[model samples]
Target: MTNNMKHIQFNNVSYEQWKEEAIKALKGKPFETLFTPTTDGITLEPLYTQQTVIEKLGDQLEKQISTIRSLKATKDFSSAQQIFGETAEQFFKNIEDSLERGNQILTIDSRVLFDWDETNISRLASILENNPFKLVLQDKNDVILTVFEQIEPSSRKQVSGYILSKEPIKIDNYPNVRTISANTLPYHYEGANVVQELALSLALAAKFANNENNFAEFVNKFYVNFAVDTQFFSEIAKLRAFKILWKAFTKAYNAESNIAVPIVAETSLRSFSKLDEYVNLLRAGNEALSALIGGADVFTVHPHDVLVKPTDKSIRIARNVILVLKEESHAASVLDPSGGSYFIECLTAEYVEKAWSLFLEIEDAGGIDAYEESGKLQRILEEVTTARLKSIEARKHSLIGTNIYANPEDDFNVETNPLFVDVKRLSTPFEELRLLYKNLQPKISILTYGKLKNFKPRADFVSGYFATAGIVANQSGEIDSIADLLNWINKTDSQYIVFVATDEDTKTILPSILENKRKELIIDVAGRFKEEEKEWVEKGLNGFVFAGQNLVEKLNAIAERLKGEQQ
Candidate 1:
């Protein structure tokens, strides 16, 4: 609980004072109503203040007279995995620290080998049954497991571990903690269905919630985790609705549990781009803030370079980003910054209604298993995904540093295993848009084929090799036999052509293209000796390839100089 939750915390500003303040703030600017609508028909306003915010909280507090329940951490049970070995103690320490460091949920990677044996299962069962760390299990089995059989009650009658079940939930994880983890890991991957994911979450939970026999056992213990990506606010509203709807249903059940179902949010680093690694910090920060304000009980800080082998620096940066937001910005200081605004409230209401309606619709379709069988879940997710991608195409969502603020002049090399980034328009003032591409070298098209990789261009581009010049590619069609390639280059009224041959045809072809005096030509072949190939590179090419350098960037820099952007 935060002190801001107390009465008189907002300074109790009345509507009149707030409006007066707004008027003064807007005095210099011409005030045209800039309220806009989102794709979902949710309205967004330019500004928000306490006047518009405080009342919503008051009203909700007044009407919903239930104690605001919260989750607490027991011992860091997530640390003590039943597996003991040389590194087990080290893993245990890391787990404890992460839990105490405020990682509220203890999650298991579903892909691990620990699930392979009965011995491992027993070890897991013991840890889950006794310890706390808000046990989250990876449900990898195609069929969901029933709780009554796998997890028996301990003395306090507590059961822990997510019970993946195709049937209704047994809720037998009580006395300690139990949840479903309602897997949405797929959502982070492109092509995963959003509507299907949300539907599955609801349907799966409902399977347990709707069952009268074990309804108390299941609904009381089950919780879900969601993969939150760059589409910040939608995920926020979606999560909030889940709570209210689930709360509404559970309230009807009249169960004995006091804690609300936990929402463990993992920020999607999948969207970050490795081309601009530093930029990912901004991406991670906003997503973290949104998840926190959206009220996730447990949140994760995924490293920006996670797509690559996660480096220590990236992980440290990722975790520190969260710490800065929470401690420095006091982001979580407000219970729900967007909670009461007419716009956010309206959006939240819309989500609650739409999602709940979807839930009911799923129930009508028999349930999750039936929906999966009918391909209904697949179709729904595809629909949501199409709509989401369309939003990107329409430029409703701006991808800064990509489409919006790309700097063609930056001496950047694309890195392998790129980082994920979510692009949004920042509220900061940018310097005048300098067209960096204007001074870069004209794109050099590489026409190559065969066992020789098209690495010099395509790989160069991906590795952030091109710094000052353009490399256009359709390498599959660029080069075939050297003779034909040379004829094509000769026909070019264009200034230069690089016909690098990768196959046996290069033996016969390389000579013909170089022999043509009509155009400037360069060959980049390694291992096999060719006098003309070396001669052309020396005469026609401007840069060196001696040291495994990313020639794209070097050549681009040369071109940039030729174009007179930089001395």
Candidate 2:
């Protein structure tokens, strides 16, 4: 018996009995309704017991938790981040400044920013020696590598690795200098699900492992970087699963089980929004929390406006998010803080099983490179991205300030840098629609009919709906007669008019109101009356604003018509 449960007296309830009680509580709803399926098609149950953990993992669970708990209690994790600068001078300045502001290590993308010649390289080398801070290079070419080779072996020890290079290089196999990385960002940024990310990355690592003559030596220097999203517990489980699976993968090659698999976590840029960019701070904070709780060795919280040139304020907030997680929350002091939860453990097991299956399938299909060359990988990701986009469109997935509770007047005209991935963001369509609407100052009049109980809810819905696109809605008083509604709408300079009434009341007033209404004003109805749509449209209804309809498509059409009218 576990320590916590020892003193507690509990009824001996069978799974069947518990299920019966659950069914009764559901009140005639099917038990299947409680089983939710993830994007990976794994069905998550409403409850989990000790028996939920698989036999293979059962023996190691306590041991692994204990090991991680000890590490968390004893050691302090260092804060690390990429230096954001376009030029060599900016790079050096940013790195120096970052190290001064509590960052222990500075990572550089040599290809993107620091394209240095020998003289500048020597200067950077001098700075490194004097500063005595760790330097990580995302070296794409031989420029950084060649300079490192020139340095004596003792000085060269400070160079962590050329871990971020897309193309694999032939470097001397050293235990200290890691060359292999599970380059997960490409897959992650391009909208691959967590299972896909793990599976494809491990498959690539396995392909590299097979080519190496000394598999153990190659595995030793291997590291991984993950792009964490806002799915709080899922991301936490993802990182933990990576560690567990890495040990299993190494064991297959008859290698040491204790070999370390270093992980660097970065907040995902996929979910970042151009509208109401302040909300990006919340997204970054939540993602950073997931990464830290997941036991990432190094964490980077990208500036909220990373897609554009980040301001000084955004950078400080991003860095401070990590600092707060480490210092104030004391996250680093409790390794695998989510370790013992049944939900997390179950999710971790599911990811591991699904990911391992996918890895094997990739290997069987020749390899990771061969699998990619077939274009099948891209197709799968595209399908998933499409589904996610549709979810956002249907309001199944809510992105506040972008899709749902957006401030239409929010403007950001700053130039954005091109991203490495071609993946589509959920907010792209909504932002485009919003931009179209922004060009026109739209005023909507909600013609409320009948009693307050009959029309108030729909009037409120119309007001919020128009506000999402920055349109001003005038919904003053409830009108019992058609003349009053028409007079009120006509007195104000409203470009559009919407009827908010009960179905019976709508049928009674719409026809009479349409006859007297201004022909130039665009007309729409608030609720979905699919059978009455054709009759209503013939009587001059432009469209219906109903739940479950694609808001992006509807808004875009309206914005285009409004723009045309202005033209």
Q: 230-259 in candidate 1: lDDT tens per residue?
A: 667766665655665666566656755544
What lDDT tens digits, residue by residue, belong to model 2 across residues 175-292?
3556777788888766789899889878878887887788876766667778888888889888887877776787888864456667767888778877888898999999988888
Model 2, position 120, has a per-residue lDDT of: 69
What TM-score does candidate 2 get on C-alpha atoms? 0.87
The alpha-carbon deviation from the true structure for residue 234 of candidate 1, after best TM-score superposition, in angstroms, is 3.7
Candidate that would win on TM-score: 2
- Best prediction by lDDT: 2
- TM-score of every model versus the real structure: 0.55, 0.87
Judged by whole-model lDDT over C-alpha atoms, candidate 1 comes out at 0.49
Model 1 reaches what TM-score against the true structure? Answer: 0.55
